[model samples]
Target: MDITCDFNTLPKNGHYKPLLEKEELKTQLLLNIRSCLSYLFPNGTFHGNEYRIGNLQGSKGKSLRVELTGNKAGLWNDFATGEGGDIIDLWAAAHRKDVKAEFHEVMASIGEWLGYYRQHKVNEAESTISWDYLDENGEAIVKVYRYDTALGKRYLPFDVKKSSYTAPEVRPLYNIPGIIKADKVIIVEGEKCAESLIKQGITATTAMSGANAPIDKTDWSPLKGKHIIIWPDNDEPGKQYAEKVAKKLIDLGVISLATVKIPQDKPIAWDAADCIQEGTNPLEFITNRKSPYHNNNSSNKLKKIDTSIWTNTAPERKWIIKDWLPVGSVTAVYGDGGVGKSLLAQQLMTAAAIGKSWLGIDIEQIKTYGVFCEDDEEELWRRQCTINAFYQLDMQSPAFLDNICLSSRVGENNLLMVFDNKGIGQLTPYFQELLADIELFQPKLVILDTAADLFGGNENDRSHVRQFIQNCCGHIAKTIKGAVLLCAHPSDSGIIRKTGTGGSTAWNNSVRSRWYLSKPDRADASDIDRVLCRKKSNYSASEQNQISFYWQNGAFVECNAHFNSERIVRNNYNKKLDLERGRRHDVILELIASEAYKGKVYTTAQFAKYFEGKLGLGSERSIRERISHLATIGHIKFFKRSPEHELSNTRSKYGYLCVEDMELKISEDQYVFIKPSCYLSATNGVLMPVENPNVWVTHNFIINDNFKLAE
Candidate 1:
């Protein structure tokens, strides 16, 4: 939201002119033009080489076009209003500000969008400081630079070896050389805090990213045998960081570890820098406040639960989808490949985002995030269009886009956890970045598509699978106080058993709820019909364990028979028979019509042969029976035609014809037979077809006592 920039150090005549003229900056902006435009106009969509939207007012239309590729990238035009400019000008218009009058502010906003602070060139001596992180051989590997600007302090890591502003995945600690020779090293939150202690002849160091540094990514081997002391700032995050560092150090086999707890009366965020600024002795301060940390895992003590607290009222359970996904837990939906699992998951998140129904099940509407490893951005975009149509929602609405966040990692390293050299599962930097993003967005539901791509460990290893789910995915779910719906592919046995689970049973046991999406098992079922079976549910009833759906409009829609177990069981046999008969009728009618159109006719036997093993219509005998039944019902007719070779004295052949193409007359004496279940009207003595012919009904009228049908 802050759009102002510091132009005090620049020439008054052309503030931010330098930034605008920088070719490198322009190139970077163009490289990420799609993301920039998305941030500026959340309602816009990328179409081909251009991003389209209504106008700068963020409306939903294609009148405004912003080039997303080639030399004309970042250029845009609004055809409806006859207005156009570069990306910066578009940003100004989006914010309803004058470009020329607010150039500095515009540059600042752009800089913020690009993930940086916009400050005009300043005197290096007055506004910046640099600290070099040396390797074991005392050579500079990376340098951490700090800049004091009008906005706030900014830190950037520069890779000395690569000569680039980008930092390495695993960065070295600050003052590594200073801590290598010393047996006792003091760790602080920031470089300034470390330097404050170092000035007092103490061996002090810190990680590159302060309290937010990745503990697993940072090298702590240099202090493997040294006595470590962590001086945390007077804040909760700082304390947590210190605890994390201490645990990592203990794992590294450190000689000892301790934490320096600030006094209760100390101001918030007080650190060693402030301590030294107050003229306090740094060494004395550490010695006085240090509390030794102990790894108490060796003790066999267990804490007992207090039952006295049970007298109080219990908290009610919450759910993302009632009885499907409980809050603050990990739920899994597994299926075979190409079973529309991804599309189903996407629709669920979209429903939550737009407050719509998914498969006729209402969901808790909230912010949602999706990490799709198999799908690309274009594929997701195409899917989104169909989903929008199904939900009758505008994809370009700000509320829709803001509530949903999506990422496509098709060909990227999407591993959230990987085995290190020691064969221990460790979180990758990418996972850390994901956690940061989720924390920032605070989404209530996170969907990770297809575990085949994201899970890096051995699927057969029960320990690895459990750890990945509970420790990694479960942590994320707990952090957001919501549920994580993970998509997975079933194994060979899993498919055979129709359980929608694979690998170790741990995969099924680890998640709180595991549902399997698969096609219907019935031989006469439609190909588009899918069944989501609840194989494991810790929080739901067993009666309604499955839901049937039919694929429609690129998403799944609930079938009419969903959750009707009693009715389904009662009419199972009749339903299958009726469905098979209907299928056979369709096949026979289609073949007859096509052959008639081609000036060719086939007998009932020939049609039966053609229908063999087709549409699962059963054997030749069953097919013939179906044809005979259709003829009996007046849906088909038998026709006699002479052969082409009249000289041979061949007898006339009979072939089937669609009844609609023929005209016939029937006398009043002809009787039209009806099903036995039909009821006779009491008022007019007219027979009426039963609504459900398969279900027998008791009628009061008795036309004849001898007219009886078997139940």
Candidate 2:
């Protein structure tokens, strides 16, 4: 807050007494009295016409109430402290100063805060001319002071009650008393023009700040039922001002409205002031050129479409990410908590900025802007570190910093659209600032992380959600000629249905593209595995569009990495099958060894039949195949034994035996063996050479040995 004022230009003596007595200035202060209270009590909340706060300490409570509207606009009272005052007195009290003791300093400080510069010299050419704004009682409300300097003419408002020079937040119309009495009123661009017309016995009024008046903040209710004629200066800005005022007046339900168009032949910016100076009656001139205004919505004609244009081939559609997010449209990325939506969005923005692929998906390389409302600067720094590592990029490199712009609005008021008292959605001032930044940056992609924070309306309301997406986000996308990716959390039902939508169906319907990131739902899926599905797409096929990613190196990598190779897949399957076979082999060998020890050995066919119902091991044929393979590898040995009899007559049958219980020999040409220093053991009846018993051999090896195998 820099004060652009020359303090030396002010009178040394206490000549400020007269300045404080200007009643018109008091009215201006009262008009914007709400803002004044808010400034003094930053923690306060507005309840209808009053701003409520805890106490003078600015705590969060409703003990102090400051009137914001009507005749009591500047009045304030503290119920607990039993203290009260007008807006000026409140300002002084907030600063811990007595109004009378430190009047000059307080007034100067207040003026500076309200965008006023206190420079008044006695020079005739640089003299300040002010016109008082009067209320319906003919009492002064505020005064607009105009100073003609060498550079240009500058105006500063003087608030009488505050004893300072500052404009009101909501300015009153000049000559309100005159407007209340007149049935037909003339609206001019500046107070000087209105005063010029008023001198000629004409009913005229103007909003403060001339052509740049805050049309939304100005009180226009005074002319609600009056017939109004807008007298615009002969210039482009003035014409636009006239159109804006006409629209507002129509919305205000005025009786009738018209515009007095200045002749093109007249010099630029010629107005009622010029007419008055030229000795011409401004009203007479305006009366000759005025025309009734019609609302644009009143047209009933339907626009005809030309099908002939369809003969030409349409241009190819543009995309920020192919088949996922189209250019100049809104895309929503929804996910459950901790699904890495924000991280994914950040990586996408970074990849787009640096002309790299994001999770194996090709992205358009362009300037990008990111608004991460949930993460603060420190958190973003940590995330960027990991993302940089994944991309093998230097964070400070020009390739990254030059093309990427990021903002963290954690713990900040990030609402872009808010519903007014009338339930109509209006873009907030902060939103305008964002648009301004986007216009300057001209980014090709904008990522607003998490919709719950930026959207200020009800999420369940379809209209509010639709308006927010199409108006706020869509407008930004259109302005930048790119894409706006809004990140959001999925609703409970959306999560259950795997649609990744939240609140109203409009969240899915309104966006041109919708993507969902969720943990893989398959039984064998890893915890780190995630699947990004295109739930909806308007310009591209989405039914089979999905990408699989695995969390690695602090960032998500396409599952198509080395882990997804065909060779790796085959090896993994083979390894699992081998483990299952080993377990079954151990079961068979232990059964055989136990049966032989009990002198009740069974034949291979009997063993196979016995295992048929014992294990979930497939069909009996499959079990025979496994048994034959094990025997072929010499893991099982067979012996002819005296078989049993059910009725005392028996025949000898071949019985199964564990190889560990039999002496074995192997030909040198048929088998290769490790050094004898490595001990041999029958692992599941398969002799495996264990170089050190402490380290078990995972693979089987055949060996020629004359000694009995160790159990």
Candidate 3:
């Protein structure tokens, strides 16, 4: 390392003054000089160290004589007022004659030290008359310069007075708002907190240091006659400061002091500056709170309080039809048992997680969280297979399902997840805590499968269920600001599909959208499976045949063909097959005609008998085959029974519709004819309807006595 020293010229203070102790302090000066030499060489003795009085002609102070002896000795000398220039020449001559190099260096060092001491001592002593650098608080720092009698000069040995200085001016200690006119002072411990108060238009100040700063009457006099609020730091020191300041204010006749405690685990702080930066208003934090510390002293104080005061504004609701619920929406999917409710929910969860379509509905990318409260090994296996099929990976491996959370945490949003298998009430805190975790991670979508499993109370009670749903929805919306999909089970009556697992209307009312699904007829083998579009929506419910799909190889697949052989066999004798074959639109028209005539409609078997029995077919299969054919060709009509019909079995009725009910305006030249299977298809055993009847009628048909043949 290299070491070098340079110096700047000294600054001029008020005036220069000489000390009166030049001659009288000669002994003291001599001892101090001897001590400096001794410090340089601990084992050396002073050969000559003396103070001479009035040795200089123009200077008022005396000079010092110094010598050093460690392993060698050095001569001592003092220069007279005019000898500074002469001493240099004398020293050079003396070195040439007898002065050793090491001895000369030592003398030179002593000479520099004496020069610095005299200059600094004189400057410092003279400038101290007023102690102008210190404030009213009496804290001041001063540099010292001693008077130099030799050479009549002041010189610095080392530049110790570099950049160390503090000015005595008052800086605003508290940030006060310009709006507040009250002459009050609120003392705080932190400048940031004081600024926070200032944002509320409150004038407050903080101790430049902490509350421990030594403040006297002068420091405390600003609020002598004004109001004082002591909002201190949270810990013991702040409380102590409050007490101390309060006592002083009391003595000064200013006793209107209020103590406001901001409850916090760490240090309590309140003010405008700190909180305004956090995007909060200080006045709101003050006026918007109901004191948790309120006492029960009076009836007014004990009045009923609404608990929602401290709650933040609820997240805005999102109403989703075909799309994902908006960042804070609560959505529910519900159906009766075996209605694929869980499957549908889980599908949405995985789709959100992977950014895929759910039931062919387009979706934007988002993380999804799903939890299944009811999962058997089979269901789990099925779910895993579905995920694998959808992702087209090895579902057996843990990685495929890893993104899907089966445990409580359920990786962040739009990622597939599930929750506890047991009831919800038992895990309220656990759910709330999970919501907190969601806020931390910020997933895109959250799905809770089967609302019933999550709730522990009586699901039939609409009010209670609504409250629970609202609570869960509120947290999810507020924290995640993301969509929430809830899986639910419909009621036992099956009146509505979206009745949740809790079996309450509240579930459907709270949800934004609802979709229903059910099995359709199979005897009319040409018809597809049905998905009922029951509730309110902007779009039409998918055709029953179009929406019903199967979960195959881990993904939802649209079925090309549906086989309802059981239904076909069970109602083979009834004309229910006509509606199944897609003639229900005409059937409804037929019912209107029949009800208009007699205020009552016949069952499906009656219509089937009317159409086929007129042709004298003994087998019900033959009549059904004909009805199915006619219905498919849009020549005849069919209708399913309404629940109000007095059927022995609760099953809906099916029937043939009259020609008037068909609602057609035919021209005089057009006529419809029924043809045997041989005319339409060789493979089909049933008959079919044809638009032209002239050719078919010429082939065969006998005019009956009861029914006239139109010519």
Query: How are the candidates ranked when ordered by lDDT, highest leading?
Result: 1, 2, 3
Per-prediction TM-score, please?
0.46, 0.47, 0.35
lDDT of model 1, residue 366: 94
Worst 10 residues of 3 by lDDT: 293-302
Q: Which stretches of candidate 3 lie over 4 Å from their true place?
A: 1-283, 287-327, 376-382, 394-403, 408-427, 495-502, 521-534, 538-546, 559-711
- The candidate maximizing TM-score is 2
Q: Which should have the higher lDDT, number 1 or number 3?
A: 1
Give stretches of model 1 more than 4 Å off: 1-186, 189-219, 222-230, 233-311, 561-711
The global C-alpha lDDT for each of the candidates, from Candidate 1 onward, is 0.71, 0.71, 0.43
lDDT of 2 by residue, 325-395 (tens): 89989999999999899999999989999999998877767999999999999999999999999999998
In model 2, the runs with Cα more than 4 Å from the true position are 1-171, 174-188, 191-205, 208-311, 566-711
Q: In angstroms, how far off is 223's CA in candidate 1? A: 6.7
Q: Rate residue 68 of model 2 by lDDT.
A: 82
Superposed Cα deviation of residue 277, candidate 1 (Å): 17
